[model samples]
Target chain A: MKELYNLGLSEIDIKNIIETYPEIKDLTDEEIAKNIEILKNINCNDKHIRNILIANPYYLNRSINDIKSLIMKLKEINIVNINLLFDSNPFLLNRDSYEIDEYIKKELEEGKKLEIIVDELESNPYIIDEK
Target chain B: MIVDELKRYMLEYGFNNEDINKILAVYTFKENEILFFNIKKINTLLETLGYTQNDIVKMAKRFPLLYSYSMKNIKQKIKDMQKLGYSYNDVIKIIKQLPAIYGYSIEENIKQKIKDMLELGYSYNDIIKMTKQLPSIYSYSIENIKQKIELYRLMNISHILVEKATYLMQSCELSFARYMFYKNKGIIIDENNYPKLFIDQLKFKRLYGIDNKTLIQMYNYDEYFSKEKNVLIKI
Candidate 1:
């Protein structure tokens, strides 16, 4: 909780985060610290981490193994800017790796280039869910 | 600087980069030139007209061309719709549903469409309600709309149902073909299963053992091409 305050989340931000994902209120300070450490392991700076928490507070409730595997899957696809991708579309972090791979394959089958797909997924990850 | 400002404004309003690229395909920003239109002013005008941020986003997404129109043109378009007895909220609803309404002309397209619908035995109130339901009806040609209504009459589907399911006005040939198929199958398509008329072509084929091409030719051959007496049919 002190770390979230250190990240500069306002009272309203904290309140809204708790209201949206009430389980955060039940997590221990150490568990919250572990999640933040996992986010930093993915190269998210403090500001990017703050934006992710605000955009989708459910990330705080995600298990460390689930978060690590999702990051690894995204990295396997050569997504270089995982920080910006998750910061903009944190909900995408919840997607299974197979779903992501299938979306890429479907787009490639439709004659889209790999580079364009990766860039699109990074900037506008919503297109993956549209598949 | 104006180009950057415009890009920033569009991004803030939730227009994705792909949407911006599509818009840029139609309009370009010249270097070292003052812009003639202002997207910011247009956003302010729409907000002033009681459109919420999401409504404006949805409308612009539907018709990115609206961003290219000058503020004066957009304002006049809204006022013209208002003059037609549509309240501000009603106009907003129409625009949200059919943002291409911004591109239509007052004298030739909008008013003429309403007048044509009135001449087609639809009361003014009916026209209003129907347009509110399906503003794309404003863009449908009079001949095409008449063909749709006539097909509904032939199907024994009431104009009231057409008003409720205005999408029935979509493809006349497709509707006629579906109607004939239902007739041949001794199946009645009332309000209950009118939606089945628009089933996917693959599903329709799998269910009825008839594809779209065969169905159109089987039933709609004479009526579909009767307009061109000497034209060679190429199905």
Candidate 2:
């Protein structure tokens, strides 16, 4: 909690996060810090990191390896604006990499260009959601 | 000591630690300046102008830079809004709604924005009407405003809808993509039925009889659908 405070989140912001995803309270503080570090390594600034956490605290529960491979898959599909992607839709990183790939594959099979798929996902990322 | 005092005052005024941090981060004052003095002065001015301390707190929270503007600048901005024909109460409403209006210059931004909107065929009343509803209109660049209005016009959306639902000004690209989806789906979007253009989530599923995945496909493959239609026409 202090780590997020030092990162400029208010108590209210942190409280809102915990209220939305109570499971987050069970994650060790170090685990949360590590997830934040992973985001910073990808060039996400404090605001982006804050937005991602607020949008989906589940990133704290996901393993570092899970996050890295999801990022790798996104990069493989020429997703260069990684910071914006996760900032806009933090849940994107929570889904299984295979699920993300299958959605992209389905879109591509429908004759939609890869760039268009990537573009739409960035703008309206819920397009890739299972629901 | 001054920073601590200011923080304490903000806390008493209902600002959270985050709000205080935002003000401290964005407001750059000279080292020798009496920061707390300036804040108290702004608070007094707002109170003198009929705002309760609670109203001032809400305004500052919505636009934290309210602490940074000089008292004179705040007065002039209010007066300028009045000069534009808003009554004193209307000016108060504008400030309460968009304290960020203090940040915009009269000639460079607000007046020019109105002029541009006027040139684009909106009457003075229309501009006033929309701005009263969405005070952020003064902050948006004329080009941004023009693009949103043009997009709505292309979709056969009524000008009155933009006046009533000012939030429709935001998200031009998403709106365009949705417009394409509506066009392909044969969903008519006019002033009366335009809400269909924006219900992008579950309500959309219930309303359109299509599931989320189909809606996503339609929005994502709008270009493909257009091409397929073109090819069919040629065939």
Candidate 3:
């Protein structure tokens, strides 16, 4: 662990990352390293990793259940247009994880049908299911 | 002083216009008065001042009355006091003491002298030249002449240099004189013994952060033409 810590991944870096993304505060050093490795394999730079962690709290926290549930919900919605979702919630276009409760409430207030709202939410990459 | 006593003597001897003016010609170095005398244009002057040839002749005969009256009516009576070689200070003093003698104040009288000098085929440069030589005519000193020349020269030189020269000249710094020679083609010091570029050179050195010692050094190296030597550094 100490050797891993010495590989340019200091305790300070972990602390800063956890503070910036509070949902990842409980993640162990190994989990954080694994997440960074996955992001690195995808050719993500420091800025991209920071941005991704900032946008996707569930990924930073290593919540597999949350990721699975979000995928299932997206498959059920069957969204055909990604642009419509981006137009509705531009924040979702860049990030892969975010709270969808407020968007749901806004859809309900606008009297949008549940299926239409679901389709819009599924098109957004950032929105995920709580279940 | 001799001219004043001669004037008194002319009054005492009852010398006419021709005689008194002839004596004036002998005593004064001004060519204009001599020109006036040679041309017999004294009559024209008398006529313009509302005096006749007979009146001038009569006044010349009674020098005390003529002198008294001339002093009283110097401005209104004389169209060309300058032609008579009246110094600016003398003209001003006479104007101030004998306000009834001239229709204008001392300053206005000086301006008129300047105007008349200009009209007499004198260029602005020539007038400035004369003014510098005879600042006593305008009640100015060498410093005053230098300041006026600097102001007039600023119209041609860069504003930055002009400002520098003005500061140095006004402060009576000798280095400013040297700077003037280097900043531009040496401005001809007017007849008044005032340096033309005095103000501009002083201003240039001051604004550009060139010290007086460095400017003096640059001035000293007239034969040397190197960039390193010209460049001024702060100590």
Candidate 4:
């Protein structure tokens, strides 16, 4: 818990993160520190960062550069609520970014707002059914 | 393998290839995903019990939750229900009417519910009768059940009100929003009247002086700090 605090996780964030992924209870303090660093590097807010971490605990293990590039792609496609996007579907990280990029383009073409598209994507990352 | 079998099973249930593909695409149930619960095992059990493919499709579609449920948990629930003197027929009826209950942990969730019902001054037979009267009873969490019960008790609502109209207790966002809206207006629901104060959308509009969409917005917003935000919204 102290390690999580040192990593800048608020009490509520730590509580919710643990609640969402109890398996993270066994994560070493070093692993948690790494997760904090990866999230902070992406300029994610504490709450939003917690949402991302809770949704995809594996992000803790991923190279910071991998997550950094994916987040950049998501931003370029106008995902207003990047945290919500991850919170809605953690598997977004595992899925092919090219497929997600194409889906975002289609949604944009349909005249949907960035927030709406992000909200829908959060719930249905495979809305385009990109296999 | 499980996905293939599920697709085949859905096809056997008369689902078109398009329907099968759509459902499989939306619901993530790959072969490795069913490690905790074998889909084939439930299929065999349900088939042996004489449930047609149509029945399974209806149950699966309406509830949209089966792959996550373990056969062991479901069997344990059946065993628990039988111990309570409910026949297998009764259990089937319960599941058919409300499939979501099939996923609830019998030992943890349902046991706590039965305990809450008992605490609410309902007898064992009365509880069974309540279940029959309202299939929605199984859908509520025990905490929400207790919260509503506490609020009802505060407002002097009778146990019979809860016993008869099960919806009076279930607290979804819309329901809770409506509750706050009406309560603020000092609109006390007539416990004796069916659709007493809140029947349909029209009644909601008439009583609350708000449109359905706005009411839905309020409901949606309650996903945050409900009690506090509701007061702010009302003001």
Candidate 5:
């Protein structure tokens, strides 16, 4: 928790995260610190970074390479608020490039504006699930 | 001082020395009212569920959210599933597979979905099996799930296969274009290979005989994939 505290999460952020996902306690300081750095490098806003971790406490469990690819995938699609995208679906980072590309292409084919698809990605990953 | 205080606190709640040690082992000792409150809430919930001391410690370490959820909400989520035909033990197992199930809004997400599935001739046993196999299906709205089902029907995908392969199929990340593109090229979206839709763009194009330039053109043209109807093979 102190490691998270040092990485720009406030006392409140740490407390809220722990209360939400106590398994975060087992995350090593180094592992969490690395993910924090990865997210910071991609988005660079403390609040956004905190939100990503809070929404997807499992972010620390993914490889940094996987996280980077997810960020790159969104950047490829020109999404402005990458943090918001991650916040809605932390699993986005775990999705392969094919999944991300197909999502964008599928929405475009249905006459959905690209921006709307991006908006949905950031708003609720649930909508993208196959019904 | 805080550790000492927490030990006394848990002891008062009928938690034994072993239980206190287990809880302390899973968390860093921080002196805060909310933290202790959460610890108490989590312990009480687990005890009522008949979790052994060892099981509580393990669950706490592996899935801390188990401890943080309001016991009331957890019970409600379980009871709701029981009403949907899963036994109490089955509900417990489902939550273990998808802890986030407890976080879902039942009325908005779960209830209508079960009702809709039943209307479509899916039995409670079938739905429960699907839910257990693909716990994330609970995340989708009833309409969203129906739309996907409708797409399969529209494409003339085998009805038997759709029902038999639903758990794996429901979770694929494929979209309408990807689905039709493969169908146009004589590729069936099977439970095994439907994931091709989620493959790397270049590899998918190469594997399925589509081209990047055409896809890019389709992507840029924007309004529709093309002006002509059924131009899916144009790729």
Candidate 6:
């Protein structure tokens, strides 16, 4: 761990990082060195690694593959999180991609000038049955 | 420097005095680089033309290079014209002369309206409620009660229905009326499930033996239909 401190991190930074990431707190010197090497291999800089460790200590001892998996999960749940963000900033939400499609389909009939793509989804019996 | 060019462009474009002044008000001038002017006056003329201040500001900011010539002096000139009383159409002509103003987009206008409505004593929920009725109203001017009335007329909503819907929308917890109003004409309702098709309330009253006052009260109270538990005892 001391050899890995090539960037000369401050005592506060080390303490903060260790406090933030519980996994790093219990790691032996050899384990910390291994984790640092793994982090560097994954294109993560020391600052980023430190920030992530501080934010979620449990991820400190996790493999790079596990971290990548966590990010994938975040993207998978993007829609639900995006909706929550939209709830706070409705004006910023892009109407074209959001509920506008469903709104147009449910509210308007076929051949309407503004009929959204959702209308196509709803009108197609195959899709409905498949769903 | 750009002011001169804007003047030349305006002359080339065959803009009138009112229109030229409007452009001058919205355009700004840097003192050291060139003589500058306030563009706020142009805002009033744009207002008369039905263009919001935000829209004009956006246009000026977006097309600084294209409109740089007159942009500097346009703002002050617009303010002067407003003092004398110019129309918004005249102002919009100048705004049109400028390219795109990002700040004056429709989304910004809606936000401004929501802010104004809140300042005018509308509650957060009421503002949201009104938004449901007239979604476009968020972008358009809410000060124009006439437009609201016209929207109601266009929706074929009767005065009695308006009274009922208004009462229901305002007093009852139902937000469907607002949704319906925005969906159809901007008329709020007590319930979303209620038939929104154009059915004259007067005719309904005559046919159903329901009085206007009672209907209005019922709609407001969310008691349009008398279920056993929902019966309103006139105390």
Could you give candidate 5's per-residue lDDT for residues B1-235 as a string of tens digits?
6667877976765556754554454344444566677777767786686555455543443343455567787778778888877878777666654455665556644675677877866677777777765564564434335545554444444244334433233321234556656667788776567455445344555676764334433343123333244222222
lDDT of 3 at B31: 56
Q: Assess the local accuracy of residue A128 in candidate 5 as a C-alpha lDDT between 0 and 100.
A: 48
Which model scores highest in TM-score?
2
lDDT of 4 by residue, A1-131 (tens): 56667645556545644543444676677766775765565544454454445334445544455556777787776654454344333335433354456566777888986666654553344343322
Candidate 4 chain A TM is 0.51
Q: How does model 3 fare in lDDT?
A: 0.39
lDDT of 2 by residue, A20-123 (tens): 45567777779889989989988776766776665455467666886888888888887655774675455565555665777788888999888778766654
Ranking by lDDT: 2, 1, 5, 4, 3, 6
Off by over 4 Å in 4: A1-131, B1-9, B16-41, B62-73, B169-188, B206-209, B212-235
Collision pairs in model 1: none
In the order shown, the chain A TM-scores of the predictions are: 0.88, 0.90, 0.39, 0.51, 0.68, 0.39
Quote the lDDT for A129 in model 6.
13
- Please write out the lDDT profile of model 6 over residues B35-139, one tens digit for every residue: 333233333444565655445543432232223323334454445433423344443343343222211222334344556666655565565554443332322
Residue B106 of model 1 has an lDDT of: 70
lDDT of 1 by residue, B188-215 (tens): 7776677677665556768989865567
**lDDT score, candidate 5, position A131:** 13
Name the regions of candidate 6 deviating beyond 4 angstroms: A21-23, A63-65, A71-131, B1-235
TM-score of each: 0.56, 0.58, 0.21, 0.51, 0.46, 0.19
Model 4, B35-137: lDDT tens per residue? 3145457656666665666666555544334444566767776777777667888877777655556655555556656878789776778777777655545
Off by over 4 Å in 1: A1-131, B29-33, B188-207, B211-214, B221-225, B228-235
| Tens digit of per-residue lDDT, candidate 2, span B1-235 | 7788888887987666765664565445435146678778998999999888777876665455577678898899889998997888988987776566776667655787798888877888788878887665664444446656766766667476545645443344445555666767776567787766666444554676764444444454224323322211100
- Model 2, stretches more than 4 Å misplaced? A1-131, B208-235
Worst 10 residues of 3 chain B by lDDT: B165-174
